[model samples]
Target: MALEIPRDRSPDSSLWLLRDGYQFIEKRARRYGTDIFDTRLLLQRTVCMTGAEAARAFYEHEALQRTGAGPARVQRTLFGQGGVQGLDGAEHRQRKQMFMSLMTPEAIQRLADFSAEQWQARAASWAAAERVVLLDEAEELLCRAVCAWSGIPLPEHEVATRTRDLVLMFESAASVGVKHWQGRLARRRGEAWVADLVRRTRTGELSQGPGQALATIAGHREPDGRLLDERVAAVELLSVLRPTVAVSRFIVFVALALQSSAGSRAKLEAGDLDPEWFVHEVRRFYPFFPFVVARAGEDFEWGGYRIPSGERVLLDLYGTNHDARWWPQPGRFQPERFRDWTGDPFTLIPQGGGDHYAGHRCAGEWVTIALMKTALAFLTTSIRYDVPAQDLRVSLSRIPAAPSSGFVMSNVHRA
Candidate 1:
C-alpha cells in the first residue's frame, strides 16, 4: 500500500558521494525526476531529498531527530560529541535557547565591531605586503575577533596555530586518510584547550564578564539543574568560535563575487545594491555546507513513499538553495534575485533551514550575516585591492569548495 521511492542502482554510493560532492544528491534527484530517492551510502540504506518541499518535510521536528544521526567521523571532527547538535526534545530547546540568547542584536553588533577593528588592523598590514591570500588572512582575523568577543583568551603566540586547528576541524570534515586524521587530532587539542579554561572558570582561577559566550556556556545548567560537563561546555564554546572562523570562507567568496561578477562592485559601491543581497546570493550560489544528516524519528509517509523509523536521511542544503523551483535561473549569480525574496526558511538554507529557536536551524546565522556585511562593507568602502590573475574556478566536486588560489589579492591600500 506504499509507493516505492526511487533507488540508486549502486550497492554503495559512498565513493560516488565523495566523487560527486555537493552535486551527489541533486544530480540523482534530477536523474530520477523526483525530489526524493533512496541510496546506499557507507553500506547503509539512506534517503536523500532536496527542493523546497523536501526541505519542509525534512525539518519536521517531530518526524526527524538528530540523535545518532551524524556519522562517527563527522562527530569526532566537525561536531564534537555531547554538543547541542546531538540533543533532542526539551534538552535541545534548552541548549538552543542558551545559544540564541547570545545572538541578541546588540551582542552581534558588538562582535561585528570587534571584527571591523581586526579588518582595519589586518588591512593596514596588507598594504605593506606585496601580495596576500585573503582566505588565510580572513581566518586569522575572525579568529582573533571571535575570541575577544567570546571572552576566550587567545594569546598572540597561539593565534596562527589555534586558527589552523579550528580551520582543520571543518575543512577536514569531508577529507580522508592523513587529512582526516589531522582533523581528529586538531579536535582533541582544541577541546583540551577549552576544557581547561572551563575548569579554570569554575575554580575561580579565571573570570569573564557577564554575557560573554564563554561565561554563559560555563555557567549554563541543564533542566535537572547540573552544570554541563566540562568537555561538553568546551565543545559548546568551540561551536561558537569555529563557525565564526568558518565565515572566512564566505568572506573569500564575497571577494570572488566582487572580482568576477560584472558591475556588482559598481552597484554595491554606488549604494544601488544592498550587501545582504550579495551575501545571500553568494551563500546560495556557492558550495559551503553540502548537506545535513538526520534520522527518521518515527514511520512517516511523504511524497507517496513510506519512510521507516530509524532511516537515515540527508537534506541537501546546497542543492536545495540552487533548486530551480525556488530559485529561478538558479545557476546564475544574480544578487537581484533576492530583492523580493519571500524569506522562505527551507528554500534559502545554505545553513540548515527551519525555526531558529524550535527546529535545528543554525543559531549563529544572524552572526554570519552581520560579519559578512562587515567584511563586505570593509572590502568595498574602507579599502582597495587588486585581484591578481589566478585560478578562480570553484569545483563543485570538492567538499567545502574554495578557489584553488585562495582568492589572491595584491596592492591593498586604505581607500
Candidate 2:
C-alpha cells in the first residue's frame, strides 16, 4: 500500500538547503513526523530518507542506482568524473573488489603503524613551534602516511600542495561559488599528477611493491577484460588518498570531543576507555557529510511511500547516525554506547552504509577507522598540548566541516 510522501511546501527550497545544510532532511522529517519526504532541489524533484530503516531500503540493490546519482557540482569536485561511485551491477562489483582487496588485516595494520610513525615524527616540529594548527599538519602528515602505505612515491616538496588540493576537493564539494571552482581546479591538477603515476607504473618507469594498491589498480581487469582509462584509474587512486587525508577532519573532531567531555578525556588519558570506542563515537556524533545521493531504480515503495523511477534521492547519513530511534540520548557525547555495538551496517553510518564489497558502502571504511584509532592512540597516550582560547565551535551548515579554529593548540610537549 504505497502512499504519497510529505512534500516540502517551500517554493525552490534549494536556498533553504544552503541555509540548513546538514539538517536539510532531518529537520523536515521531524516537522512532518516521517522518515521520508518529497521535495524540489536545484529544480529537480528529490526524495529524501532518514533513519536506519531508510538506509537499508535506500541501499537495496534493485531499488537504486549510483549512475547519475550525485549532483554535478559534487561529481566535478569530490568524486571526480568516473570512479567506483558511478558504477553499477557487474562493473561496480568488480571495481569494488579491487578496493576491498587492499583492506586485509595486514594491510590495515600497516596503515595504522604508518599513522603512528608519521604523527610522532610530525609532533617533533610541533614542540618547536609557538602554535600548532592540527588540521593543517594532519593533512600534510596523512598525505605522507597514505602515500607510503599505498606504494605511491611522493616527493617531499609536493606534500603541502597535494594535501591542499585533496582538502579542497572534500571541503568544497558542497560549495557554490569560488571555492567550488577551486575544488574543480584542484581535482583536475590532482588527476594529472596521479594519471602520470599510473602511466609510469604501467610502463615500468617506476616500481610498485607486490599487492600494493597502485600495482593492483594499475593492473586490474574489468569483467569484459578491459583496463580502466588512465584518468579513471587516477580517480580511483584519489578515492584512497583523498579520504585518508579527510580523516584529518575527524581527527580534529576527536580532539574537540575529548575536550568537551572531561570525564571521557580523563578516562582516555588514564587508559580506562578504549581509544577505538572514542574514535567511533567521534565519527558518529560529529557531522562529516550531510547525505549521500543515489537515483531511484525501477519504481519502488518504502515506508508506505511511492518512489518513482529516475528521481534523485538522498540518504541522510548524518541524521541516521543521530536518530534517537537507534541512538538513545542522541545529543549526548557517549563513547560507552559503542562498546556494545552489534556491528549493524545501517545503524551508525558516519561513512556510507550496507555491504562494503556488495553494496555502495565506502570501500575505505576499515582504512578510516585504522587511521583515526592510530591518531587517538597517539593523542591520548603520547603527546600533550594546551587548548588556548579559540573558536572551537563547528557550524553545522558547513558540509565536510571542521572546528572553526581548526582545533588550534599550543604549549605542546610529550606526555
Candidate 3:
C-alpha cells in the first residue's frame, strides 16, 4: 500500500493520538498494517513507525542522524541545544563517553543508598501527614536527592518552582499550538538556572557532594580522549536532571499498579518484591517516552514505503511495547515473560535496544531499575500506600508520563 498523506489538516486525530496514544497507534497499525500505518502521522507529514524491524532500522540507519534540526530544536529548548544528543559523529560519541563514567555500577550503588535515605525521610513526613500527592511528593524527593548529589543548593521553594517549570517545558515541547513558544521560554529559563549552577560547581564555589558525580565526570577525559567543555557539561547535567525528574513519575506509576492490581499489592505486602521482575514489568507497562522522534537522514524504502531524506519520523515506543508480534498479550503487565526468555536482549528493550545500531538508549536503565527496586522494597515492607482511590491514568503524550493527580498515598503503618 502506498503511504498517503492525510489531506485533512485537522489535528484532532493527532491530538487524540497524543492523549491516548498507545491505543490509537495500536488500532491504526492493526487497520493499516504495521508497514504503512506505523510510518504515517495522523496530524502532520511526520512519519510514525513501530514494530521491531522499523525501530531497529531507524536506529541502524547510517545516513540517519539524531542530532538534526528537529531534535536540536526540542533538545536545545529542553536540555540546552548543543549537548550530546544534539551532536553527531565523533562529537556525540565523545560526549556520551564522558557521561557514561558517572553511571558506573559502583557509583549507582552509592547513589542507591543515598536515594533510599531520602525516600525514607520523605516517607516519614508523608506518614505524618497521612496523605500526600504522589506526583508532587515524588518530584520533590527526586529534586532534593538530585540537588544533594549535584551540589545545586536549591532551596525547597526553588526546587519546587524549577521542577514545575521543567515539567511545563517538557509538556509544552510535546504539545501543539503556542506551546512550542512557551516551552522555549521555559527551556531558556531552565538552561540559565542549570548553567549558573554548573558555573558555580566549576569554580569550586559549589561544594562537591554525593550527587555531583556527573559534574565531576564532565570535567574528566574519556578513554577516547574526549572531554566535555563547560557548556556541553551543563547540558549533560540537565540531561541527568531531566531523567531524575521523570524517575519519580515512573515510581508513582508502579506504586499505583501495586495498589490497583489484584495480587500486585499483596505481593508487595508479602515482601516478595523481586527487583528484576517488578522493575522490568513497570518499564514495559509504563509510558516512558511514548514516542521517540527521529529525522530520516537519507531517502530510503522500508516496508515498501519511501521515506524522503530529512523527513521526521516518530517511533511509537508505546505501540512497539504493545506490539502483539513482539510481546504476547501485549496489553497485560507480565514480568514473567522476561524470566526465562534469555534469547536476544533486543527483543525486549524497555530502555531501548542495540549499540550504535540500536539507538541512543537511556544510560540510567540499570540505575533506574535498582532505584525502583530499592524504593519498592522500602514502600512495600516499611511504608504503606493508603490513598482512598488511587488514580493510575497517564498523560500519554508527556515525555516522561506523569500521573494526572500524581500518586497520592498515606497511612504509614509498617507493612
Candidate 4:
C-alpha cells in the first residue's frame, strides 16, 4: 500500500510541536507510512522503521542532500560568502580536515585542562553569591573556556552580551518575522568579530595564551596539499565557535537531569554509574537538535511511498532517538539500554549517522561527550540545588528544548 500523505494541515500542526516533536512524527509516520506532508515553506516527511535500519537507509539514499541554499543564504547575510558551514562537498570536506587537526586527542586534553581550570575559578565566584542564576554562570564558564582554548580575548562583560545576542540569532533563524531580522543583524556583527579574530590569530598578533586551537588551525597545512584559504578557514573557525557556544546549554541540561532524577543523582553522587552510560542517557533524554534538514538527492522509494527527487526531508532526531522499537519504554531515560546491547553504531546516534552526514555527525562527538562528563562530574558531586525541584518544561515538539533558565545551583560543597 502506498503511504497517504495529508495535504491539509492539522489544527495544531506538528510543525509547531518542538518538545515532543519526535513522538508526534512517529505517530503520524506509523499511521501514514513514509509519506510527505506540505509545510508551506518546507516538506516534512517521516520514516517509521527502527533506528538501525531507518538510519542506514536514510544515510544511504542518494536522494538525501543538504539544502545548501538556506544555509548559504543565511550565511551570506550573516557572515558573508566564505564559511565552511555554507559550503558543500569538496570545499566543506577540506575545511573540516583542517578543523580535525585542532580537535585531536592530545589537543583536546590540553583544551580540557584549560576548561577545568576555568570551571573551578568560575565556580569559586558562584560559591560566594547568595543567590546565583546558574545559566549566567554556566555561560560565563563556557565563554571563558572557549577563549582560553581558542585564544580569543573575550572580556567577561563582552562574553555575556555577545553570547546572549548569538543565542538570539540562532533562535531567530528558526522562525520568521522580527526575530529572523534580528538574528540576521546579530549574525552579521558576529561574523565581523569572527573574521577579525581569525585575521589576528593568523598574523601571530592575537594577545593572550600560546598556541590555541584557532591559532594552530590558522597556521596548519595539509602537507600533501595547500593550507585552507583564509575565508574558508574563518568559516570553519566560526563553525567551531557556534557549537561551543551551546556548551552551556548542554552542561545545564545534564546538571538539571541529575538534580531532578533522584535515582540518577544517587548513582552519580555514589560513583556507581559508568560515565558512558550516564552520558548516553543524557543525550537520549535531553532535547538537542530534534530536527535536521535534508533534501532528496534523487527520486527514491521508502516504506511504499515514492519520494520525488529534490524534495525536502526533515529527519526527526528526537523521534528516532525515542523510537519504541529501538528503545524499550521509549520515553523513559535509561543509559543501561546501551550497556550490553550489541548493535550497529548507526542506531545509537544522538549525532546523525555516517561520515557523509553533515553538521550533526562531525568530529565534535568525542569532545562533546568528554566535556559533558567532566562538567557533570564536577557539578553533580560538588554543588547542590537550593530550590525545590521542578519539572524541566520543554515543548516536546521543539528541537533542542533545554531548561529555559540554567539549572540553578547554590549550596556549594565538595563531595
By lDDT, the candidates rank as 1, 2, 3, 4
- lDDT, each prediction: 0.92, 0.90, 0.66, 0.62
TM-score result, candidate 2: 0.98
Candidate 4 global lDDT:
0.62
Which 10 consecutive residues of model 3 have the lowest summed lDDT? Answer: 3-12
Structural similarity to truth (TM-score) of each candidate = 0.99, 0.98, 0.85, 0.84
**Which is the leading candidate under lDDT?**
1
Candidate 1 per-residue C-alpha lDDT over 154-251 given as tens digits, one digit per residue, 9 for 90 to 100: 89999999999999999989988999999999999999999998898888788898889988999999899999999999999999999999999999
Ranking by TM-score: 1, 2, 3, 4
Ten consecutive residues with minimal summed lDDT in candidate 1?
Answer: 54-63
Residue 45 in model 4: shift from native, Å?
Answer: 9.0
lDDT of 2 by residue, 352-384 (tens): 999999998988888888888888878877899
Model 2 residue pairs with clashes? none
> RMSD (Cα, Å) of candidate 4?
3.8
lDDT-superior candidate, 3 or 4 = 3
